[model samples]
Target: MSSSAPWKQLLLNSINSNSHLKHSTYFQLATVRSNGRPSNRTVVFRGFQDGTDKIQINSDSRSCKIEDLKHCPFAEVCWYFTETWEQFRIHGRVDLIDASNSDPYKLEQREAAWFAGSVRSRLQYLGPTPGLPSLDEQPSHDSLDSSAGPVDVFCLLLLDPEQVDYLNLKSNERLAFTTARSVNAYEYIKVK
Candidate 1:
């Protein structure tokens, strides 16, 4: 947040203004498949990576998005704020942090996300692998371990934005921001 990304303030404002909405934090992430197709899914915002502008997202390692990211490592997040009638199209490369990652800081982030998630939701990661036919009629409630830590399949996604396209429909304003990975400051552009 201390670093200078031109769209940071606008995005923060949008999030703040729309925070009251139940789905305000939901954003659509689009990734290119290895087969050249596009895959998109709505993911919850897990806050930023501390003081950095990179967006934090939690994922299951068994999910297709993980495979898609493994293949391309790039994605675009389309976030809309209905309260303010604003949209931000943020495109960036994602950095994945999983159980295999040895970095201490990244590992801490993964653990933090695990604890941040609701027990009911976290139980899903501990159950049968996704994308398979349901084999059990009733997933045993006794099997859930609320006290357990994040499983090996739990992962963290950090979306480091290189460019942001912002549109404010209410004000009829549009802006674009581009920042090189080499520096914190961005080259700002006015689209209208």
Candidate 2:
């Protein structure tokens, strides 16, 4: 519940230091399925929510990840920076903001995320749901809007970190940044 997550600075530094790599923005998100199984997928990092440490990611409401989150909001984001030889395991709870969401601020974030997306990215959402064969499901060029604005299926996934386990392979150092929820603060513990 801390506004400024202690690990945010380290993550931002890792991102800035390795900005040249395109895959730096990608991370593996692992969620719990309804059947108590773990589902993992690679997702792009949209950015942190405005002025907050919450991680933001664009999602499709129809996506299995959404269903997974509904079953359990908890997830872990695993990010590795090849250039820096560092890895971060962010344990958190995700907040979903879609058309059905009633929160105004979250809805605003969703709208902003939609408009921030490229036309091509926006258009993809109009196609058939993920994992489905799309030959007939494909929308004609003329049938798709270039803007393709935010659809009900387009959702914003925000992750509020509960703990961040950061590892530096080069230095052989590991640290755990855990939230002290009762005090709205974070405790930094060096791990072996």
Q: Estimate the TM-score of every prediction.
A: 0.90, 0.90
Report residue 40 deviation for candidate 1 (angstroms).
0.7
RMSD of each: 3.7, 3.9
| Predicted candidate 1 versus true structure: per-residue lDDT over 14-129, tens digit per residue | 88989999789888999999897999988888888877889998888999999999999999999988889999999999999999998998899889988887776676676677
Q: Provide the lowest-lDDT 10-residue window in model 2.
A: 131-140
lDDT of 1: 0.84
In candidate 2 the C-alpha lDDT for residue 97 amounts to 91
Clashing pairs in 1: 1-51
Question: CA lDDT, every prediction?
Answer: 0.84, 0.84
